[model samples]
Target: MPIIGMCIDLVAPSLPAIGQSFSVAASVAKSVISLYLLGFAFGNFLSGFLIDSYGRQKIIRLSLLGFIVASLMPIYLHSITWLLFARILQGLTIGAVSVTLRSICADVLPPERLTKLGPWFGTMWGIGPVIGPVIGGYLQVYFGWQAGFYFFAIITLIAFIVVFIVVPETHFNRHPLRIVSIKNNITEILKNHVFIGITALMGLSYALMILFNVSGPFLIQTTLHYSPIFFGHIALYLGVVFVLATFLGRYLLKAHTVEKIWLIAINVSLLVGIIAVIVSYFFKDSVILTTLITALMFISCGVVFPISLGKGLSLFRHIAGTATAVMYLVNISISSIVAYFAGFVDMTSLVPLAWMYLFLVFVIAILYWTVLRKS
Candidate 1:
């Protein structure tokens, strides 16, 4: 599921081609990135509602179906606007895939196993982005950008079949769907500070992540004039670092709980931020240095994602669908909005956005100690 979480990241390199096809400005191309995030936010919530109203398995089926179809069909549409429309649909389906997968993980994994399995989820997460761009870049360079979509479509088709055949119904409650219960259920979960704060943290963390993710291709390929394949390799390097960090985080968590791990994430994120800012100042023009800085920033994400998510949503097992969807939506929405605003900047300079990420974490840390220490 986390691998699928990466489908868009893989598509990042194709943004320039998309711009040329659409005849829009580079910043406008960035909105192709933003529109997807917006769709993700909306779809996350919609996915939850579907799960509540229908069932988890059914919703999963629907999302995968749409994902595969959208991937296959949208490439033929030439206008960037039309492509953006397709990407939006892709994001929507992917949201369902993420929300349902997380809800299931929250359901199936016991607290004991969650500690170990938590990081594996992050590990899988780290793995996805690594491959997404490498594959996307190859498709774009050798075949053209349209091949990227077809590639994802084929992957989705396979996943859809596997999911349908093996995934079980997880609702536990066999009762007919009740809209009021689903609505009230969301309200109940939101009332909890632990839930809101942790989820809010996910939002902010992802916002930082998307800023880097969305900007990477431009920063690497356009600014540095690296080949798409070369930038993809850089992404691969970053993913390798992230995968190792996630495993290390999981191993450490054998001796720690979610709170302790979150603190670790905070400390690492601070370092990552400081390093990123310094790198942006000194080596923003050097693709290698910038990649390393960005990769380091993502190292903390592997830790933050699982800890915050597992800790935040654990108490809401009864409303896992609504809770998980809401969480994913908010997380991506904040990131997307931040990234959209980032398009305002000259791509040549990455300091403002990097500093913004650093500041968000610094504030979150201070608040954690002062108010939400228990978090």
Candidate 2:
């Protein structure tokens, strides 16, 4: 799961450098992130059935190997086209691993236990965003953009070895590869309004993060003339806030129903979004104020993501792999589209980004009240 974050955040600080290296606009460089996410969505769609048919271990090992290989492609090729290609490959492989890992958790853990452990899981996953930019920032300043890809290769290699040696197969109830059965299962899951609503909420929450990842560097580094390392530290700070908020969410869940927690979180996010727009409008270049407000919004996401994901996955445990895949596929696909269009938005001020945040939260509210609450 951290691999997914690493794939995105590790290269984030280098986006400008990547653009300079290839003599392109920042928006063109951002295509790397958007295309990676498209590949992730495709991979999830494909891996779900393979995971259900062949089980977890085999797919995990193969995907890790592919990820290692793909991680090395951009280091040697030096072309943005090749970099995008490699990133797609990386996304594809890592996407598979993500679905497989989630399925393994669903296979071994009961729903209550999984929900209880959600904060810990989110913390571990949060590590990538926490460290990726901090490391990437220095690498960009000292070692150049290619260094991030080299780091990716090294870390994925370590992960590959660990999984091969330590992780055991968890999915035992292997379904046969039948087209009709796969279609039916997908149709059934999609037909569940609760699943659809929860996944939409998840997608919208995640898109907020993706929008920032897509636009933050240019806003902070390019617009405000901050150093990549400085931006990295900002990312680190936000990541910490996200991790801490997940624990806060865990504590709240113990005392409240999931519905109540979600409602509180969503409304809080809306309020934060309102604050962000006002602050950005008045103090357009105040990075501190922007980061502070963004952190508040992240607290909402941290609270919502684990609860939504656990609840959504629990609904179709008998087909955990497929459900996980469908859930991530929809969410990441939404995120990818957002990432792509985000590049076109002006970064001269934080107003556009703040507005985007507010609008997304508003939509999340609409989805919840109209769809999720009833379902």
Best by TM-score: 2
Each prediction's RMSD to truth: 2.2, 1.1
Q: What stretches of model 2 exceed 4 Å from their correct place?
A: none
Residue 147 C-alpha lDDT in model 2 = 91
Q: Which regions of candidate 1 deviate over 4 angstroms?
A: 174-176, 350-353
RMSD of 1: 2.2
Which lDDT tens digits does candidate 1 get at residues 1-375? Answer: 755657767888787777787788888888877888888888888787677566679888999999887787666666766777887898898888878887777667765554456567777766777788788788889998888888888888888889999999876653346777776877898788777777777777666567766777777788778888887788778778777877777777778767777777787778777777876787547666676666766777766776666665666766777877778777778777877887766677566656776886786677567645764
lDDT of 1 at 195: 74
Among all windows of 10 consecutive residues in model 1, the one with the lowest summed lDDT is 110-119
lDDT of each: 0.75, 0.87
Worst 10 residues of 2 by lDDT: 115-124
Tell me the TM-score of model 1.
0.92
